[model samples]
Target: MNRKGAHLEGVFLDFPDLIGAYLNGTHLERTYFRWANLSNVDLANADLADANLEGTDLIGAKNLTIDQLSKVKTLYNAKLDPEREIALREKYPALFEKPDE
Candidate 1:
């Protein structure tokens, strides 16, 4: 399937309809999904850095963050408002890591 700009993290899930395209394993690397609905899906190893998921409906997607659910981020309507970035950055300070600090 031509995902326009959907990042198929390798696994093109073949299941029920109500959801967006399936992406289980495709070596996803910083892909953009402007408003894609990814509810209830496994996206481990998917590099979502700098990916613009504005207004994306991830109401049930699993593992958008890293490692375990504990690292979960930007899923199930993850407030993408421009103003939210400030708060998010404040909440997760480690995000601003120096490359060679």
Candidate 2:
């Protein structure tokens, strides 16, 4: 699934298995990813602003920086590398907030 630079705003992806997908530079603003498996996905330069990532599996995701996660609406229950999760939580506590309606 190569969707580099694609505009996917406001899309709803429930439990989608997108492992190893290439989503670099994609526009994922306001997207809903509930319990989705995005492990090993390339998210370099992807715009995840206001995206809902509750219960989303991002473990081992490639090019996934804390800066990108900072812009997301929420990361509650999102699976990430232990160290990365700690760093993100310490740097951006608001991203762990409850999802917005």
Candidate 3:
């Protein structure tokens, strides 16, 4: 689905199949995306602050950057491109921490 620039704050979307969706510039603050399939999705300029991204699949997601992931609530077990994952982990280790940790 194309939801570029849409305001989707605090939305719950666990386990959603959102492969290749266009979500660039979307406002996704505090959204719940646990275990969601967002592979190849376009997330340029998307606001993901305080969002739940545990176990979400972000492999090959377009326009995703370390700055974006840094603001997220968590990425525990989330799937991302190897290089990006390494970069994120190195720069923002807290984002990968479990809630109970």
- TM-scores for the candidates: 0.44, 0.94, 0.96
> Which lDDT tens digits does candidate 2 get at residues 3-78?
9999999999999999999999999999999999999999999999988999999999999998899888899989
Sort the candidates on lDDT, descending order: 3, 2, 1
Better of 1 and 2 by TM-score: 2
Q: Indicate the residue-level lDDT of 30 in model 2.
A: 92
* lDDT against the true structure, each candidate: 0.43, 0.94, 0.94
Q: List runs of model 1 lying over 4 Å from the truth.
A: 1-22, 66-101
For every candidate structure, what is the RMSD over all alpha carbons to the true structure, in angstroms? Answer: 9.3, 1.0, 1.2
Find the 10 residues in a row with the least total lDDT in model 2. 92-101
Ranking by TM-score: 3, 2, 1
Candidate 3 local lDDT, residue 64: 92
Best by TM-score: 3
The TM-score measured for candidate 2 stands at 0.94
Q: Which stretches of candidate 3 lie over 4 Å from their true place?
A: none
Cα lDDT of candidate 2 equals 0.94
Candidate 3 local distance difference test against the native: 0.94
Give the CA lDDT, 0 to 100, for residue 29 in model 2. 99
| Total clashes in model 3, counting residue pairs 3 or more apart in sequence or in different chains | 0
